[model samples]
Target: MSGKITQSNNFIYTALALIALLISASLVNVMPEGILEYIIEGFTLLTFGVCILSLRFDKAWTRFMVSIIICWLAATLLYRLFAIEMLDYLILVLMMVFFWGTFRSIARQILFVGDVDTNKVIGSIVLFLLIGLIWSIIYILIIVVSPQAFNGVDGGPWRHNLSQLTYFSFVTLTTLGYGDISPRTPFAQVMVYMEAIAGVFYMAIVVASLVSAGLSQTKNSRE
Candidate 1:
């Protein structure tokens, strides 16, 4: 049972990291624009599918939340494929809720787990990437609501906009101000600072939690 659990955890973390890589690649501008969008969509769907499958549902509520995520994914894809502009806003709202739920679920699992094993370490990394993705989604939402939210982003479809924003998200999360992308609006500026702070605090908390878990495991072994 333990081996199976570890395998499942490894698969999910791998998928998460792969999705982040795909997004990063999309930002490099080397790939043909049309093909990159398709690749990103495919990988995103695959990542979400893996996340849903690998999630450890400990209660009825979590199971229900998973179902909701499935429905959100389906709706978002449909709207994107059909180019339904009005409904795309609704999709953004759903995406925010889904991402928040996912972050909460994963954070809870990591914080409450009894052992500081490889799985937990991988989970911590996944959580960090998830935070970046969540902030990216928020940046997208800001752009959607206000066209002037940010500067230096190319004018194109929403898919194209995400490529740049996703890159900017991780950059800001790591406190690496590349100066390539800047927030034009006050709200966007505030969000940028907030994400920076969140990134710092999250790292500090994860390190402390891991150290605590490791000490507890060592004490138990000595006993």
Candidate 2:
């Protein structure tokens, strides 16, 4: 049981590391654009790999999802290397599934557990980051379907657009509207508003849950 807990903690740490790397890459302008994008892509792949490892599922389901993720990752890489237009859609879909599964697993672990521990706290943070990632993919999908969904985002390679969308997603998630990236379409605006609400609600729920869990643990110890 202790070993299992340690593995879970490691998963959260890995996710946090990936989030930091992605944000750092986005903010740093010293590197050439192409090289920066390549680094970001590398981190993206690594994130997917870590997410797969972090997934908590029954054996059959685990095997199935892992197989699908592996196939999608391979196809996404091949299409990206060839500059295929499908790469954006592929990655968008892949991230949606990945974030959904990861969020569900982490939420379950944190909410259902009886004890409050470091892993639960870390999982809460991971959940927050995962929410931002999910919104980023949603933003990308909107842009893919309608290129004019956002203002201040230039029409360019999807990779560049993805990086920008990611930054925008986190900014929106944190409710730190810098006024630089605004949604032009109603659909985009709706998503941005939803993400902002989700960010607030998620934080509130996690704090409540953690506090309740901690109190329960203390009471149980006394009994």
Candidate 3:
């Protein structure tokens, strides 16, 4: 809310998100076995778009968020229909960009919103926590309902369920692992660990940087 956003940056992000959606759709129900990267790949680009939107949420915040949802929906439909290896790899690149943009957005929000009106700040915090909590709870419920199918992880009964996969993804994202469900395959382990590291860095480096910077500035101004 404090800084100005360039239209060029927004258009770039929108373009990437849109392409990711279209590519993801093309692979629907068409990917080969042992390759479930399509979903991740699709979401990686889509989420990057969301992260970008977070930064420059000016007059078009609502519309931008809606567009993100539409992209996700399109991706989901595509993954269900076809699968593609190349597209999955492309998603990896998207994830890299997404992580960077996500942390940047968080840092900026923490910095800019600190000086805003109390009610508005509090409302934003509550809204963020609420949406995050609701999403996690529903995800956990789905995992609990069909643990076997989800935990199977080998095109078994849980291929469609995706509970275990989703669970691990969040666990790694939040850097919380209860040890009940873990990555069995080497590739899975690598993915989860990478996510955990990314989460840690985001919190420690970006979030902490914003908070500490604010504190230092406030202290200096008082002096």
Candidate 4:
């Protein structure tokens, strides 16, 4: 019974964690520099820890991955304490891997394994957010390498750029293309359009999955 409850609420937990992370990041603009940045970084780490707990599995490999994430998280926090610039890259790479793995797990669950429940439907939304986050990490990585990768963005710590990049990522994903944050580098431009394509395909696939789930439920009722 506890396991069933956990399964049902897993996505809810993950969604809330992601939302907290986003909110904290979005508030960075209002926050003063120096110590506040570290505070935000700490909050980000806390939310990520929650996400890891919520999405963890009993599988051996999953356990191993979780261990690695925990270690990375610890190291990131340590680096942040010491004011290490390298921590920026470390955190971005760690988050990218974590988001990608969570996306895969949720996609397999909702797209392949089961009938769509409310939680599963929410999982689809989580997948969309994960895509934005994954691309945001990519964009940040590019910015790290080339400060001029984006016209409007400065080459700052990934944490400082998190909100803008995340906003740009989702904007590009939805093909809204407000043009406020244009990609300057050729590779960054390529990534922007690719994210747009992915967003379109993701919407179509989600609609199809919902339709299929509805049909399957109806068939089961008839049976």
Candidate 5:
């Protein structure tokens, strides 16, 4: 029982951290350039740390994530201090790695290893958010390489463009191409379509997981 409670708390904390990251990313537009950027980066790192903590079931896995986080943090600080464009790509790549790791961990718990409890249900939502975020990082990377990858985005620091890219990412993930932002390059187009496909299938996958969990619960109750 205590273990279950602890797992529940981890899920709740991770959920809250993800929410805060989303909010901070959304607010990047209104925030001014220099100091606020650092704050956002710090907040992002903190969210990543919380996510790593939520994976405490595996000490080795958690350690690996910490090392990635450390590398990401170092790259971020150097980018900020030196204003290096290359570091932007590095940071985005590191961020993507961490998010992908967390996404897989949460997905396994919710989809395969766990009962259909409230925490598992919330883990599904977290998985959805991770999908959006992971795609956003990919979009950001493409933009950093080819500034004209998308029609609606203007060239600037990735941080300044994060809000717009993130919005576009989720919009694409939900298959709601608002037409305000359109992917031009072949790579970007492919990613957009893939996200759309994932969005369509995500419901099917979650429903299947839930149904399986329900059946297992009924069987256990009978026993």
Candidate 6:
């Protein structure tokens, strides 16, 4: 109710949003399939939990972008757990928003690391964690959703597809295109290609920014 309390709630929500992204990413990609999908679903609990939190949080333009991506990451993970179908175009829109928003936020943080402290530094690690998180969520969604659209036999290796999808998402997200498990459907191909471009641009921009900024800082330190 109070202004200070409101601000505090907002800050906490933003932080929690970042945390959910990291934690879900870990469960989705790093764990095995049997109970792991269920465990991964557990992360969806964070999504509902964060809904009110997301509403409460207020952020800067930069931080706003970061939080938007967080929303997509959380939503996609939830969709993965329950949707059990391939991504529709709307989901792709959300994914692109999440991907671009995350990429920009990371580039800003890495390039302008000023007055950053212990907590903020750990939070900074989310930049890297996020890439895996968002990609894995989408991949899982693809594996799960693609079945309903691409296959009719009610057999799509739900777990195995998810696991492979994780790898494939990162491969495409990173623009690696390993020539294995390529998309057979137009929907998958479109999603993969778009994500691949996003991935490539994100790295190009962020890495360049980091390198330039780091070099500049080094030169200043030497002076």
By TM-score, the best candidate is 5
lDDT to native, each model: 0.73, 0.74, 0.45, 0.82, 0.84, 0.52
TM-score of each: 0.84, 0.85, 0.40, 0.90, 0.93, 0.49
lDDT of 1 by residue, 108-207 (tens): 8787457787777877877887788779889988887788889987545666677688789999999999999999999999999999999999999999
The sequence of per-residue lDDT tens digits that candidate 3 reaches over residues 8-65 is 2343344344345434533534667546454644454454554456445644444544
C-alpha RMSD by candidate, in order: 3.1, 3.0, 11.0, 2.4, 2.3, 8.0
Candidate 5: where are CA atoms >4 Å away? 1-5
Query: Which has the higher TM-score value, candidate number 1 or candidate number 3?
Result: 1
lDDT of 6 by residue, 3-46 (tens): 34242233344356656644554464466656665554454445
Model 3: lDDT equals 0.45
Q: Can you give the lDDT of residue 170 in candidate 6?
A: 72
Candidate 6: stretches off by over 4 Å = 1-34, 43-107, 112-125, 139-160
Span of ten consecutive residues with least summed lDDT in model 5: 1-10
User: Pairing residues by index, what is the TM-score of model 5?
Assistant: 0.93
What stretches of model 3 exceed 4 Å from their correct place? 1-151, 154-159
Better of 2 and 5 by lDDT: 5
Candidate 1 Cα outliers beyond 4 Å, as residue runs: 1-21, 24-37, 59-62, 77-82
What would the per-residue lDDT of candidate 5 be over residues 102-166, giving only the tens digit for each residue?
Answer: 88777877885657888788888888888998998888888878999999998787878878888
Error of 4 at 191 (Å): 0.5
Model 3: lowest-lDDT 10 consecutive positions: 126-135
For candidate 5, list the clashing residue pairs, or say none: none
RMSD of 1: 3.1
* Cα lDDT tens digits for candidate 2, 122-205: 778788877887888788788878889999887666656666888899899989999999999999999999999998898789
